[model samples]
Target: MHTYLGTFIGVLMVLTLQRVKIGPWGGTGGHAWDEGGHGASAGGYTGVRRMSIGSSWCVSSMLFEYDDNGKRVKGTLQGERDNGIPEEELDFHGEVLTHMCGYHDNHLIRWLQFRSNRNRTFGPYGNLGEDKAGWTRFEVSMEHSGSIVGFCGRSGNFTDAIGVYVAVWNPERFYDSMRRQGVRVYRASPLRMDLRQIEEEKKKEEVERGRLQKEIKEGRERLLKLRLKLGVDVLQQYQEIVQQLERGREGKRQTIEELQVEHEQLERERGRLRKELDLKRLRESRLEVELNHMQTWWSKITHL
Candidate 1:
């Protein structure tokens, strides 16, 4: 049994090799298979084949690969380098890309097909003149199969307008290069969030934010009030100090005036005392002269 299984596996490998040599399956979906055949004959793609879709306002390019049957197998949606797709529109682009490439069952012809059928889906806005256009370009391989199928171009008319520009690539080479560079790919299922739930959460957050803002404002107001009260107290204290200084200055002034009056009275008294002393000295001098004369006369009488 083991020998039989080995033989079968060997035969399958031979068939696969033979198929690779012959070329891939015929192209489908209206695109010609002749180019695809040539690529398969070359064993792999030599360069990049790019395709641009949509008008100037909402436009994109895709690098992609078709399976043996010419159906889009895998691709990469790329954004412009300079005027990149708006960050808000990234999720919308990603969703569309995921549906096209990740979900293998979906039929994706153009980027516009990826837009939601609901009314007023998001997209880019403004005049779609040639001057306002931006594009993203990538190469698709006709040789190998890939995980990406195609990308879609879309625009939104919402307040936050968005433009999607994508570039697609052959996933086989992309994965091989990543493997060579030791890049690991982790696969996870996409999570769907309800719009109502998102809106509710946003409302809750806004309420909390408002509460915090109010607290901050109240705190500032309280601080301002305290500062004003302190200012008033300081002004009152300053006024009291000025009043005390004024009172001190008036008392000093009155004391100086009293001292000046007393000084003047003392001066007058001193002048009167000095006049009395001069008169007394003059009387003493007269008495001394009279005594001298009397003595001289008495001496002469005694001699006679």
Candidate 2:
């Protein structure tokens, strides 16, 4: 029951994804689309090809179709734009499209990808042209036998786009179709690389990456130390300011204490001055009274 439910969900997802605009052939909605570069006609592709931005060349491919068992059923298309990057001897600007489809295991479909290119001859690095209205040629071969069906390619980019598209139908029928289109279908072995050797090479790469990361970390540490040294200098300057402030406060406190002592001494001197002033006033009054009494007696004796 669970298996059936999962199958239903998968089919629903496929149906939903199919709604997106794609090629009339139900493959990548379009190719080489860059704002004004998106459109389609019933015939083969045309117009001047432009390279992806910033790249010395523009190359892209997509996987548009796959079988229920997860095998590709379409070919691959790659375009290279020349910006004088490759040596100036090779024809660098051209497009290649390859198609190969068959079956290997019950669930695995095998296909070969090939490309066709057309560009000017400039020794090694051919100048790229902006027009796609040029002649091109392609060749490919593959071999397999089983029940297969359909050819479609999904649209995407290097990081976001699918890889390639393929069509895995009956080889006999596909062969005839290719022959008519001037495409030759034949038996051939797919190119392969040694896995164990690749693993050893991967280990070596990991070790080198580790060493680089360690070096970066040490460099960052050195930078941090320099920043810390600057911070310490700033802190010392702040400490000096605080000490100066403390000394200023101490001096102010001493001046305040001295002023307080002088104020008390002035208050005592004022009290002494008031006592001396009262004593002088009393002596002057006594002398004035005695002088008045002597003058009156002398006048009476003179009269007698």
Candidate 3:
């Protein structure tokens, strides 16, 4: 019964996830701390190609790399400008940004999550701070037939306010639109690492991963060989013990059989002696009767 219920629940979940069509739900919700910085925008014609995010506990900054037709356009930095902060990169490969969800305190965004056009989800950057109070949930998705063109937000210290610009798949007027108010340059935020640096770091990590995988495989092989040898030794020891027990049982059987044979012979000898004694007693009685008869005959002759 539980198995059937689980299967039904699984089917419902799949159906619910598949309900999303090829476009956005158009909510595009994000977070902001305070509104002292300039309202900024980041996006392009073909939409966001990649993003670099810097964060720790709260989102520190973000930079967008856009695709203008086939050309690359770097969007200006959005947020703080300090260096050495850890950053996360989102390379769409070819997918476009479609939706976002986040958690934030009254001061700044604590975490941010994104979903691409292909339904790929990325990140919950920052943290759900120790004090959960004053934290609020924000979510947004494109409503109609458009992908996200760019981001517009107030910045400084951290991203203060955030919003998405959604338009049709490929609007030629996107350049003019960005000129008016949008993300145009793909410049790196000093606090956030650039895409080139990130790519190099990823390459180094992959090499290290390959080395670690090889070591793990070798270790497993050695461990397996040791286990097999130990198993063989244990089996041989048990076999010797079984062999000893079998020999001991055979010796016991032989001793019991010999003792039984001796006991049967003694019992037969006792029976034979008893029969001989009875026959001797009967013979003595007959001899006595004959002697009496002879004596009587002699006495009668004398008298005559």
- Over 190-236, each residue of candidate 3 has an lDDT whose tens digit, in order, gives 12323434565689899999999999999999999999999999999
TM-score of every prediction relative to native: 0.34, 0.32, 0.39
Q: Any runs in candidate 2 off by more than 4 Å, and if so which?
A: 1-212, 295-304
**Cα lDDT over the full model 3:** 0.56
Q: Tell me the alpha-carbon RMSD of every candidate.
A: 20.2, 16.6, 18.5
Q: Which stretches of candidate 1 lie over 4 Å from their true place?
A: 1-198, 297-304
Residues 109-178 of candidate 2: C-alpha lDDT, one tens digit per residue? 1112222222121121122344433323232332221111222332333211212222222446545654
lDDT of 1 by residue, 90-126 (tens): 1221122211111100111112222221122333322
Model 3 misplaced regions, further than 4 Å: 1-44, 81-93, 169-304
Clashes of 2: 36
Give the Cα error of residue 142 in candidate 2, in Å: 22
Question: lDDT value for candidate 2?
Answer: 0.35
lDDT of 2 at 194: 27
* lDDT accuracy of residue 220 in candidate 3: 97
Which model scores highest in lDDT?
Answer: 3
